[model samples]
Target: MATDVTVPTDLWEGDLEAVITNWLASDGQAVKQGALLAEIMVEKSQFEVTAPADGTLTITQAADAIVRKGDTIGRIG
Candidate 1:
């Protein structure tokens, strides 16, 4: 089974959506729960997003992708 990783709704509020600034892990890589997976930039501030579960990361969205709260970014299995 696969687990969808969506952006946290409570992440932040702004006029524009968040942009992925950095990817700490690569697609198809094994990531542990609570590990830093990527960094998001919103309102000129950077925030790190962690893996929700221990599994192989499958990035459905690419780096530098524009995203919003509740958007599905990837899946883990």
Candidate 2:
């Protein structure tokens, strides 16, 4: 089964959407749980997205893509 990589709903306090700044792990790459997977920016603040479980990463959203809190940006299987 694949684990959904969602943006944390409490990452920020505002309603402004975030932008995927960079993907630290490439698609299909093996990763461990809690590993940093991507970077996201909201307004002027930046945040890190981590792996939900140990598995191969599958990116569903690319860098520079706009995203909101709780949005699924990738998966791990």
Candidate 3:
């Protein structure tokens, strides 16, 4: 089973959406749990998204895509 990688709702203030800056890991690449997977930007603040489990990365949202809290950005399979 794959684990969903969603935007963290409590990482920032307000109801602003974040832009995916880039993906640190490539699609189908093996990633360990807690590994940095991507970067997101909201206004001037940036946040790092990490892998939830040890598995292959499958990105659902590409770089530069806008995402909100609770949105599934990728999966760890």
lDDT of 2 by residue, 26-60 (tens): 99999999999999999889999999999999999
**Residues 20-62 of candidate 1: C-alpha lDDT, one tens digit per residue:** 8888899999999899988888989887788999999999878
Model 2 alpha-carbon drift over 4 Å, by segment: none
- TM-score result, candidate 2: 0.97
Q: What's the TM-score of every candidate structure?
A: 0.90, 0.97, 0.97
Q: lDDT tens string, model 3, 5-47?
A: 9998989998998999989999999999999999999997999
For model 3, the stretches where C-alpha displacement exceeds 4 angstroms are none
lDDT of each: 0.87, 0.96, 0.95
Model 1 whole-model lDDT (C-alpha atoms): 0.87
lDDT of 2 at 76: 98
Taking the candidates one at a time, how many backbone clashes does each contain?
A: 0, 0, 0
Query: With candidate 1 superimposed using the best TM-score fit, by how many Å does residue 34's alpha carbon deviate from the native?
Result: 0.7
Over the full model, what C-alpha lDDT does candidate 2 score relative to the true structure?
0.96
